[model samples]
Target chain A: MAVTRETLLAFLSKKTRADLSKIEDGAELFSSGVVDSFVMVDLMMWLEKQTGARLNPADVNLDNFDSVQRILAYAASRAR
Target chain B: MSGKPGIVVLGSPRSGTTLLRRLLDAHPNIACPPETYLLSAAARFLHADQFAAGLRIGVLDGLSFAGFEEAEVLARLRGLTFGFLRDYAERVGKPRWAEKTAFDAFHLAEIRRLCEGHVKFICIQRHGLDVAVSLRDLVDKTGGYVQELHDYVRRYPEPLEAMARAWIDTATAIAELADSSEDAISLRYEDLSADPAAQMQRVFEFLDEPWDDELVGRALAGTGQVGFGDWKTYARSSVDRSSVDRWRSLPEPVQVKLAQICNPTLERLGYARIESDDDEDDADAARRRYEFGLLLNRMKNEDS
Candidate 1:
């Protein structure tokens, strides 16, 4: 299954119990305290299960997980 | 303790001290432990608080009454604390030991005095605002039980401000330590993240220890020990520079506030000053987001 922006949003919303509407595509998640590191670890494992491959540490970082838009782009990049 | 410590790692919490400690600990000749709070606690014993002062005098007077000299009392204190460290180092098959605890940054002079010229200090620094960001994140993640940084966090109403103050005070103490101590060396966290191998080489050189390719590999893998240090470090398999400018993504008001609070120390430490708002376009956000996600995956793997 492909991970989309809405998929990531729904996950974050469920995990953080934050309003989905309040979470912006470009909003900082980990840095802004919307999502903490522990949730991030869970999300990363979920991403690996979805993508069907283990993530490379070199490829893993804040650049791919800080926002819904960025995460989708990361997913798209990994799909390629 | 069993042996005199040859190295002391000093830095503000979140300034990459844990990473450095893991690296130093991996070295064959050096055994760096997790935060022991021993040196800092010893420094506190020397504090001039009325109660502590009275206790020290009372103990010394009692010891004197028992024919124990002041020098002997001091020697006993050193033995009791440093012996454990020495034993740990020997148990780990390392010839020398190093200790790193964040609070020890505030007590460099006292630590040096107590170590009696047997210690060399390695002080690590990061841009104050970046440190402030992580510090705020830590307090949020842990729900205000950051004992490593408890002293600064409790004083301010705002987390960022409190974190900024911590960076400022710790950086200032490190700066003073570098200036006054011939045995002290300073390393920037930005530089370390930029090239950890080179930075570790520089550190090994400072300690007069041999640097090996295997040591860098071990350092990059990190110690899996769970303790009071940065939890994020446990997940890191390699150094990444994404966190170098993380403060740039902060809200403009927050950026300005932290910049104002930390600009002096930032300038002193040779980091750029954020005098006003800077643009962080969507592209920047995308880059940072991707980096964070990747770090998360690595962390997850380590967690499992």
Candidate 2:
């Protein structure tokens, strides 16, 4: 199954302990401190587990994971 | 604590800091409260010199407010940060105050410089697997002490691995910082848990407090901080030896994965690696070496 925004949301909401409903798919997670650098590494590792997407340095740039929508797009792009 | 004496407890998340804080707080003259989160909460007020509004801003440490709102708001209330804590201890009539934060290790020097009076630094270390498992348990809660590894909770291939990475990175950084700091004492969680009275006696002596058999007795007998978190260590008076050697209960594969991600750190910290089949360990080592060779080959190909 293609990983969806809801899938990313559920995983991140649990990981961040954030309120699931408030996290719009478009919210700026990285810039907003909802996810910081150390946590960002863990998120990349989790993304790989959920989507089988291996993240290199390039994939971790803000464009790919700054928000839920971007993360979903990045994961889909890298999925095997 | 420029004019008065205080204690700061530092540890990896779940490394028994709260327990230690409660024990110290149990002292008659000492008041140890829950985390203040000072560094992170007040970082927006800092200037280029790391001071908030011309006053020294070295009070908070381990906060990653790299680029936050440059609100001058944090500057206006700079005195309130340390003053509030100081006045609270005075109002409560306790001569001493203690703050516990795992990130204190990152800002030890700055904190020591910020304070004019003597500040005793104490740190605790725990095994990665046990901390990881406990962190895993906190994945579902609304509010828990898993404040340290909040991002490492998830399914296989990442959770334990990410936990291992966090443990390694943090332990290495904190250990080095603690080793280099003056007036700092370090203890292992296993040693403290196994022998509370003796370990705590050493701690009491370090803080220049006369050890009362009563304080140790109180810490062991469920006197205070009972069920504070309501999870594993919350409100429990007695240390459960059951938490020792938890890696044995983890699946063997997960154990190996933890060792792989955390091997260098575990080895550095003198924690034993998980036992594995010799053939399997050898094969995995060979595979890693092969992967490195492959990466080198790719780089060479690109260069050519």
Question: Please, what is the TM-score per model?
Answer: 0.66, 0.58
Q: Write the per-residue lDDT of candidate 1 for residues A1-80, one digit (tens) a residue.
A: 68987777877676555776656788887767788764675576667667766666776666777778788888777763
* Top lDDT prediction, candidate number: 1
- Local accuracy of candidate 2 as per-residue lDDT tens digits, B1-304: 3344567777766677777876787777777766776643443333225455564443232233554332333433445565666776777678787777655544444444443244677878889888777655555464632434544433234666666666666677667757777777888889988887788888888888778877866755654443233255655768777877776666444566677677677777778766553133356444544443354344334435
TM-score, cand. 1 vs. native: 0.66
For each candidate, report its DockQ versus the true two-chain complex.
0.13, 0.02
Model 2 compared with the native: what TM-score? 0.58
Residue B111 displacement (Å), model 2: 5.7
Ten-residue segment with the worst summed lDDT in candidate 2 chain B? Answer: B55-64
DockQ of candidate 1, scored on C-alphas against the true complex (2 decimals): 0.13
> Judged by DockQ cut-offs, is candidate 2 incorrect, acceptable, medium or high?
incorrect
Residue B114's lDDT within candidate 2 is 46
Q: TM-score of chain A for each candidate?
A: 0.87, 0.83
